[model samples]
Every structure is written in structure tokens, then in C-alpha cells.
Target: MIIQPKQRNIAYRCPECASSIFGIVGKFALSADMLRLKCSCDKGSALDINKTNDGKIRLSVPCLFCKQNHSYVVSESVFFDRDKFLLNCPYTGMDIAFIGDEQTVNSELARTEEEIRRLMAGFEAEDISELQPEDMNEDEILPDPAVYDTLRFLVKDLEAEGKLECLCNEGSYELRFCDGGVQVYCERCGATYTFGATTPALAEEYLNIDYLKLK
Candidate 1:
């Protein structure tokens, strides 16, 4: 199924111009660019990411309430690190996802400008009905806003500092990550902590929040 833009829904309709607001994200081949989010009204914006992250892929489109656009840099971990990670992209049925980046996104827009211009020209001349489709059934299930905001800040920082470290407590421990689920165990302490779980307590260890919530 095609990924539908979130804005066309009745709920996100604008009170001012009644224009739809949407946030789209995708990457181009071999480039780190966040595709420009274009509105039917000709409003376009770009975002930039610092390359130090060198992560896989990430995108943060603005909310319906606010039109400011933002982009993120993430690595394969976003998809591969999930608890029940799907091996493929549902929209394209592809093994790899078109990860979003600002630079890559701009290239796509430039390449497609002619097609887009044709569409826009038709739109300007005709009094066309709003071809708003239904909202997508499978929205990107991001973390709850309160929680997601913190992860955006912490995950990269911890990963960058090489501080996402795991130390063995009194008990023997094991660490395993496959298909997005991880297992951190202390065989000596006979303890285990799943991501974001605080259960299976360990005697002595430094743990990240994702690992602590598994309880």
C-alpha cells in the first residue's frame, strides 16, 4: 500500500487557507538528503543534519499544527532494532527502505520537478475537486511524544560517546540483538533486561533507559 500523507485528513485541515499540511520523508540512492516537503500552496522547506552521526536514516516531519520542517539522521538501528522488526518495507515490499535525508530528498525533488510542474499547471487552470484520500491505516508508530522526544536526544548522544556500554554485574550476563529484540543477561546474577524494560534486575550495572524499561 502507498504511504498516504497525514495532512489530507479532515482532522488536519487548516483553519486559515484550508490548505492541507503534510510531512513526507524519503531518501535518494547513495545520498544523505532529506527530501523537501512540498505543499500544494507552494510552501517548501529544507532541513540539515550533522554528518558526525553517520547513522543510517531518520525523518522528523513537522506536525499538522506547526509547519516548520525538521530532519533527522538515523542508522539501520531504527528499523533493525525494533522488538518485532519486519524484514521488509510494507509500502514497496523491498528489503531496504528509502531512508530520509535532506540532501537526498532535494535531489529527488529536482529530478521530479518537471512532472510536478505539469501537475501543478493542471491544478492551477482547473477547478478540481479536492482529491483527498483517506488517512493511512498504518501510521508510523513512533514512540509517544513525551518519550520519543527524549530518545531523540539521548540515543544519539549515548551512541556517540560510546557510552551505550554494558557491564557485567555479580552475575554472568549475555547480550544479544536479533530481528530488533535484544537480550541482556547476567548469567552470574541470573538476570535479564529487555529494551525499555526494568525487569529481570541485575545487581550492579550501568544501563540505558531502553534497557531499563524492559521490566
Candidate 2:
């Protein structure tokens, strides 16, 4: 006997670019069916349709890397037949992250959101005046404006204290950006220091250090 599969409409949004893609998918095609959905912006996601142990349909989606929040949408049979579908960042060709099941995914998402809220509360309690710029001085060369400004100010502060000098104390240094990070090297003593913002979140933490004591 041959049984015809069911069809449903599923929509996806990129996590990074927030671009949307929609398509009609089969409900009972196979246990592990993957449909590649690419947004017009070039980023995409592979929607995997699988059957749970309890004979339920499952959809696995990849999330974005840059964004802090994970997004999802739920539709009755037309979209996913379930409560929700995993979302991915649209800037990249593929989703940057994937979790096992929906239950675990929701739990993880709640934890992540709560952590972000707590961190924001902590940041709000701190004196952020020093971190804020009074004037507009933007450097297009640096990937992160905050890091560039902070390092520039740190150098000026160290120079005023005569501590920006290399180990020889008479050597001069040069700062440059490379491989998405900043590097400082001395011409006379060959002393070098590098600050990298490998991820967006780590950029500020890297710039918040005392660079004068790198002897």
C-alpha cells in the first residue's frame, strides 16, 4: 500500500539578518528530511523534519551567532503543527547553533534571557559615564568603535603617566588592527601586545584592561 504524505507551510527567519524565507513541506516524508531554505540576503537554514519517539513531528532549526536572543514562531499544522519552530540567524549560510529538543530548547532560552536581564541590571547599577563618549569621533578602520576609543584613551592615559613606553623605557610603540583585532608593538624593544575581539561580546571586556602594565 502507498500512502500520500501531507503538506504544510513553514516560515523561517535568519537570526543575524532577520531575513525571512517560506516554503511548503511534507508532513510524513521521512524520519530525517531536510529542506534548505535560503533568504534573499544569502543566509539560510536547513529545516530538518524528524519523528519523535512518541510518533510526533519535530523540526530542528539553527540560531544566529551575533544576536543575544533566540526567536521562534508557532502555528497549528500550517506552520509546524506544533507549538513552535526553531529560528536561525539569516546573515550566515547556516544556523550557528542547534539544540536537541524543544523542551530543552525552551529551557535554555529562558535561562539565557534571564541571564541577560540580570547582566543588564548589573550594568545599569554601574557608573557608565566613563564608558560613554561626549563627542563624536568615529574610526571606520576599527571593527568595534568602543574598543578603538577605549584603547586610544588608555594609550593617552599611559603616555601621560610615562608608562606607555616599552620595557626599555625609551622605546616607541605602534598600534594597528589585524585579523579583526588590535596589536601594539615597540620599534626599539620589540615589545608587542595584542587585543582581539574574537566575538562581539568579548570586545568590550578586552578593552577594559590596564594596558600600561604589560611589561
Candidate 3:
């Protein structure tokens, strides 16, 4: 007889790139203080797992629907004993992460993607340009909430590290939200760095940037 280690597959969508992230978690993996599951996108987004002194598992999950990180604590049985478990965004009620048997998780993900495609098809038929009033300026349009929030968080982190600067040698900067992206500009020199955030791929790419140079 052979003994198999207790393990379960985990899956989630990259909050920055909207790409599916998959991994496996073993019962022994939690022996450490922390376990991190990072996306292959290399966008700095990851799922952190911590075991509490009380034998509870704490999960820090990143959400694309609400542009926020959510934390949940569960018993060890709930984490490893379930055949399938799903974590959803509280605000949108959309599944943000999955943990269970590999086949179940993969099937659910495919169904979710199909639903999204159907919704997008309907959205494409509408004339979005006509919905906006002709008198409305481009600046009046609100940026995508997920993209805007991600950029804002990145900017704050960069500023804290003293990596955000302008050619004029000024560290003070401001953000301007436009239709498809946001602009970081120097308050004193007016130098600017414009980045696209219209798509998840673009946003994920920007997340890799460590320093911002306004020119």
C-alpha cells in the first residue's frame, strides 16, 4: 500500500491581468509561518496564507471585481476537508477564488468565463458613444474603478519608497484620471507619465514598474 499526501488544488484570477492562476496546497505546506501563491503575470499580486495560533487558516485574497483585498479566516477542516470551496467578492457576488478538486475548479471557471462572454456580447451591441451627451468633456468620464484603484495603490507605494520623481527634481506629484488611463504629473515642472489602464493586460504590465519618471 502507498500513502498519498493530502493536498488540494487552488485557483484564482489575477487581479491585475485577469489571467487564471493555479496552484496546489498540501497539508504540510501550512507548517510554515506563511505561504504565498503568486501569479505568473509577475504583477506583484499574490494570495497569502497564514496559520493562526488557534489552528485557523487566514486567506488574503485579491479581488478584481471590487479592486480590494479581502481577508477570510477558516478552520483547518474547512480549508482541506472540502471537496470544493469558493470565495466570492462581497460587493459583486462574483467568485474570486477557488479551492477544491482540480476538475471541479476547472469546470466552474469555464462556466464563469462563458457567462462573461455572453454578457460582453450583449454589451458590444450597444452604441456606447451615443449614451454620452455631446456636451460632456472627455475628462468627465470616469476611469475604470479596478484600474484606477490599482494605479492609485501603486503610486502610493512608489511615493513611500521615494521612487516617484520628476525631471525637475521634485517629488511632489498628482494624478489625473482620463477615459482609459491615468496620468502622473509633477506639480512643479508639469512633467508627466501617461500609462494605459484600459485593459487588464496593460494594467498588469504597469504593475511591474518600480520607478516612475515624469518627462
Which candidate achieves the best lDDT against the true structure? 3
In candidate 2, what are the lDDT values of residues 164-187, reduced to their tens digit?
Answer: 657776764445455656665565
Among these predicted structures, which one has the highest TM-score?
Answer: 3
Candidate 2 deviant stretches above 4 angstroms: 1-142, 198-201, 206-208, 211-215
Residue 100 in model 1: lDDT: 29
| Backbone clashes (count) for model 2 | 8
Q: Residues 1-215, candidate 3, lDDT per residue (tens digit)?
A: 75543887888777667788888888887867588888777576788888888787777887754445666655666678766666655334456788888998899789777755665566673332322234523234434545544565566557657788787865455565554577766768988888777754676678878998789
Candidate 2 weakest lDDT stretch, 10 residues: 69-78
Q: lDDT score, residue 208, model 2?
A: 53
Encode model 1's per-residue lDDT on 38-124: one tens digit a residue: 345434333222223555544443322222223334444443232221111112111111222334334433443454345447667
Candidate 3 lands at a TM-score of 0.53
Report model 2's TM-score to 2 decimal places: 0.29
